[model samples]
Target chain A: MSDTKPLVDVRDLKEYFPIHTGWGRTLPLKAVDGVSFTIKPGETLGLVGESGCGKTTVGRTLLHLYKPTGGEFYFDGELVTEKNMPSLRKQMQMVFQDPYSSLNPRMTVEDIIGEPLDVHHLYSGRAERREKILSLMETVGLNAEHATRYAHEFSGGQRQRIGIARALAVNPRFIVCDEPVSALDVSIQAQVVNMFEDLREKLGVAYLFIAHDLLIVHHISDRIAVMYLGRIVEIADANELNNNPIHPYSISLLSAVPIPDPRIARSKQRIIPEGEIPSPLHKPSGCAFRTRCPYATERCAAECPELTERSDGHLVACFNK
Target chain B: MSDTTPKKAPFSMQIDPALFEPATAEEKKQQEVMSESTTFLKDSMKKLMRNPLAVFSIVVLAFILIVIIVAPLVVPYGYSEILKYNGMKDKTAMNLAPFQYSANEQKYMAENGVTLFPHIFGTDELSRDYFIRVVYGTRVSLAVGFFASLIVLVIGVLYGSISGYCGGRVDLIMMRIVDVIYSLPDMLVIILLSVVLKELLDGSKGIIARLGTNMVSIFIVFGMLYWVGMARLVRGQILSVKENEYVLAAKSIGTSSPRIIRRHILPNCLSVIIITTALQIPSAIFTESFLSFIGLGVAAPMPSLGSLANAARQGMQSYPYKLMFPALMICLIVLALNLLGDGLRDALDPKLRK
Candidate 1:
């Protein structure tokens, strides 16, 4: 991964949705505020956070699925702008969280998977298009016979595989996989994860894998970025971020992950942090996480810390860290 | 159910090879492929075909279609042609009963040694062939109903899609415009416009003159008054359909807004569109009949059912069946159309299907 430019580089991304309060007036819900990250080719960056922390929003914004209110993104060294989105989309794809709503119920599997090819005018003739669709089904571990079926005909895992096949249809270099496995059964989760790993090995595709499951994220990601209240508080190599978390929120979050061995897990101290996440509409001044942080000081209340690297490229946002 | 024998390999596989084998050919042959794929349209069509009432309605409508098309060709009398016998006028043929001939008609037939066809439904007050006039009236009324509804459909689909898809200030303004249209007294506006268009388009050479002053005015009224309901329905359908994630998926894939609306949004809203448009046809027909009954329908000499009914009302004390015949024709048409519309509504949306 050295000496090569990252395939996806996001700098100071902000996505705020306006809510109508009354009359003509409205207030902004700062869903993703000043977030930044990078993913090298063939790398997986796990994004983990509690629900409503804007993890899904980050994934969507990175792919321009939701237009960024303020930010600059570079895909393969080319700047991302609205004018170039049609071509840029060929390189970037997304696997949505809900297997149910993501696929159009009316369309056959072939049409759903072949949509990108149709939009791009990739195939010259009908025969070639059919062959490509069948091959894509084969690549995703779906039978060619299932190509003529619809989304409702499939189980949850099968539907996710269809969505994956659609994402890979364009032969994209990067994908925003937003909790692709969270909706499936635990028995099906490992099978899908192994497929992702194998596909990554075979195709050299990079992923921004967003989830609330820390164990799954730890198992798959080369690096991990933990989000809190629409901002990334810490990011480091997966093992380092899990074992030696520098920020208070990260330590607390990691404390919740139950170790598989019951003898050691029961003995582990769980931080059961107090208080609810403050509403993003009225975010706390200084550090957004300080209201929930145990080590928050007077100075911590006075200023927000920039995400600076402490050592060995482990970036944390707490001043005490 | 025989399984294929495993292929012989010199090297052992990492996992069992039998796991990948096609176990039984019965898996393929035990069931036939589904003959027809399930969809809102095909499923609804199946349901519609199975409904005896809908099928009967369609048959009645088709019979009307064929009769109107072929009746004038076979009938001997022009709708307005005054009958004559032996170089003299036969004024005694007024208000004759169905399948009856006057003494003058009989004398002409015997003198010529040729059979004069009896009036199939009888003559009117003008001694004109009532059967031929009724057929022509059916043609005109049916045409007016269908075209007016088409006008409503085109305008409504465009207005509703634009208002629903845009959804902010534009939607607010467009919906208010629809509301304004809805609240306006439609009959009063239609009457006033018909009076005005009757003056401007009577002899001025244009498409409206070809349709005559009354029919053109009726069309214009329909264009103005009928689209709001369809627009409101399409807007509601689109509002709900737009929330589905496939629309978002289409957007993320760089599909243009128009393409997304046409492909993703409209197809989902098709159930509503079909039901509304189907029902609108009969509404337009009923409105036309109401207008014609009030003496504002098709002009003189060009018969319409409502006008015929209006004409028959004066002779109702003596020739009551004259009123009954045209009135019965109107009822049959409206009823058939309404039943077909109901069937369409049931067939197009499976959510409402029993």
Candidate 2:
């Protein structure tokens, strides 16, 4: 997998939002600061992080939905910029988190899915457009008879399917799934996750799946990168990270995943981190997790650590782990 | 007893071929439980139909519109023409009661073996047919109302959408301009424009000559001042609607900014726009009548509802019906429009849906 060129490569991305503070003052809120990673062709890179840790911001900035403060993004070894973003949009799409708000209420299912095709002028005629829309709906497991219905008439799971069909209209090669299943029921979540996996296999589409669910990420991702305070704290193979988490934050996060079996869950020890996650506006100096880390030291506070290879394919950002 | 016998052994493991067959087209159609497809406008119209008040208002408006169009064709007397008998001025026809005729008109009709059309609302102080004058007044008021609201709708939607979609500095500056416009006294603007345009449009032909300077200035004031309210409303709606996830979805698909505003944002703001435009009609009509009442409306010899009412005020003591005719017409039209606007608000608002 590593032998093939990376489909999406980022070399330090930054996004800062200027917030007004009255009296003609403006403060910069660093939403995503110097985050970097790469997704190989046909591989799923799961980005796991707590709320407000800039997981969604990274996905948005990569797609140019939000302009990057500073970064370089390469797709298929070609540099991406505002000039070529429109063409690149056809190759990259996004499935938003909320199903209800993502689909336009005023639009029918066919129009919603056919919108991307309309914008890009992908189809030849009305017949071809209808054919493309119905086939896309079928691919996302929606009934062809449901084409004319509004978004509000469908259930949550079905609405998400419509949203997915819309994202897949252009047959994108790389998709950013921003917590796609987080707003769904557990039963529906499994169905959606399985559909995503099946789509990846059939279409050979790479995905940057951002989710806070560790178990689901471990189940579907080839590589997982854990983020804390707008930075990637760890990156490793899914199983390697699950079995041997090196960063103090990653260890605590993995331990927090609920074990299904009561007998084994009682026997397992959960590592609870102390204090609260620091605010992105006023993040702690040096290491963001040092305030909550049990292995904090003078060196950890004096200098921030960069992600360095600790094992065969495991990377951790910590002085001692 | 024979039918009770087991068909093919209870709970047979063999699969039934019939069960695995694909659904036929008829069965597939039956599986779809949704009702017939409806567009946003059709859906809103359906809801509007369910409201009795809205339907009543629509009927009333339609009737008034038809009457205004047809009355002039049938009425024998022109709105501004003075009554004459045998090609000479008939002074006795002045201030005749509704359906009443002067002795001179009766004698002329009797002698000529021809019956003249009865004065439906009687002759006014100037001996013009009151019924025809009322009809013409309605026509002028309705036309002014429609054209003014249209002006407001076009200018307001454009300004508001641009101000809203472009946030921060652009929005701030544009909204400040709206605030300035909002603070200007509309009555004073109309009075000033009427005086100024009256001089500029003197002896001008075409639409200016037909509508008169006062009516033209009233429309100008409506275009300039009335739109600020609509602009503010549209701006507030767009501020909230542009934040929806669907708008972001549109941007991600590379839709142009104008397309986003037209297709995505504006449709969501339609309820507000429709309600405001409906309500705006009555106010525009009222403003025209008010200006005319104060002698700042359509010029003399051309009748408007307000001017008609103003002319009737002199005979209010002896001929109260003169004032009543135009006044009643204004009241009915404004009331119907107000009810329709309320009904539209109720019907179009999604939050009010059951």
What C-alpha lDDT values do all the predictions have? Answer: 0.85, 0.89
Q: Can you tell me the DockQ of model 2?
A: 0.53
Q: Is the docking of candidate 2 incorrect, acceptable, medium or high quality?
A: medium
Give the fraction of reference interface contacts each candidate recovers: 0.40, 0.63
Tell me model 2's lDDT, rounded to 2 decimals.
Answer: 0.89
Local accuracy of candidate 1 as per-residue lDDT tens digits, A81-149: 988888988889999888888888767789889988888888999999999999988888998878776
Give the clashing residue pairs of candidate 2, or none: none
RMSD each, Å: 5.9, 5.7
- On lDDT, the leading prediction is 2
* Poorest 10 consecutive residues by lDDT, candidate 2 chain A: A259-268
Each prediction's number of clashing residue pairs: 1, 0
